[model samples]
Target: MAESKFEQSLENGAHQKIKSLVGKWKGTSKTWFEKDILADDSSSEADISSILDGRFISYDYTSSLNGKPLSGKMIIGFDIPYQKFTFSWIDSFHMGTQIMQATGNATEKGFSILGSWGNPEYGDQLFGWRTELEIISENEIIFSAYNIMPGEEETKAIETIYKRI
Candidate 1:
């Protein structure tokens, strides 16, 4: 007898890779607005958990931005039918009133998601955002981002280095 693709994915698939992120972590994050110029540095905490019977990973995190409190929730999963990773995120600081959605796949270390952020004042694209992650080990991870704007060169917006606590 053969098993269905859905059943096979549920037991062993890309979702397993996403599930590896579950844990508690503490780290430091650096924010930049210009090339090689550090804008801010702050401490961060990550609380990751598996939800809906291991179908999705929900991560909650906290930190500070420019001396104010910052928090966010990130949900990640693998869509078996689509064969790509899915991500939905929202934060108290960056997202004004919108949820940032992205889709990408697992890399050698972690995963990267490319998505657009910001709404046009008159219906035009404002900017693009890419979130990249690398899990060096079970206890250590690196997360970074690239912000793309029209005409201007790409820039690193934030980089977070986290370790299990």
Candidate 2:
């Protein structure tokens, strides 16, 4: 007998224990656009909230890089037919809107979210954009962004380490 895809995903999501990620966090982070150190910043905060019983989660992020404000939100579905997450960000300073899909699971260190997405505003400035989120704790996380130009190599757009307040 073989387990169904839904069954497998359910087991995976259950074993992942993503509920440990619910909380509020504060930390400093830096933003690099196209591997060119755009700014080194730390005035940022992140809030993560979730309802395990409801199978819903949300992330609210607010930050400033070089005096410009950046904000984004992510909504996730857990223990469902398909375990996945969705993200959307509107960056006022960079003038970009980013949307991404993610798959997550519990790990020894924390929850790991592997995702990929693109930014329309930076399409010309930077190509083939994607991001990764590593939840270090209930209040700590690391976010890294990547971009690959048509002819040039892939670059890390941003890497930020966050901590709980």
Candidate 3:
């Protein structure tokens, strides 16, 4: 079948939005295990790139957590067929082998994705997960994660502030 006009164009708005993230960023991540107690804090570096002819944004980052190597990769794409923003994330940590994914609309500042991280083989999840990616500017971004347990308050588990290098 002939490719749709969107697939044929590399200059779409979503593509451009993804393009804006292509750069190196220096940042720090704060992981909280308790309400106010200090937990793991680490410096991080992110190298984002526009790949697959601007159809997707590749995000790769590395940091040390508890003196062990921690790294992750995320692919951000706009699904033309479904008209939704698509994303998949994998990491050396955070569930180990679960390829958490979510689809949502793009916000003015950035995007919000909601998915679950649990036993990959099981159906229901122990908790729900929400990921927010907000752009502060061309120079900065915020990545935050929240955990939702039934009949409990939404708890913020992780947040990383990235500034372009």
Give residue 20's lDDT in candidate 1 (0 to 100): 78
Show the colliding residue pairs in model 2: 26-165, 32-157
| Candidate 2 lDDT by residue in tens digits, 1-165 | 998654454456542344455677777777776367675665677777865553555767788777767777766554454544434444554434555555655445544455544455546443444556676665677777666575787777677787766
- Evaluated against the true structure, the overall lDDT of model 1 is 0.85
Per-model TM-score versus the true fold: 0.90, 0.64, 0.86
Question: What's each prediction's clash count?
Answer: 0, 2, 0
lDDT of each: 0.85, 0.60, 0.83
lDDT score, residue 56, model 2? 55
Candidate 1 per-residue C-alpha lDDT over 3-53 given as tens digits, one digit per residue, 9 for 90 to 100: 877557666767667687799989998998878899999999999999987
Model 1: per-residue Cα lDDT at residue 41: 99
Query: What TM-score should be assigned to candidate 3?
Result: 0.86
* Candidate 1 Cα outliers beyond 4 Å, as residue runs: 1-7, 10-12, 121-123
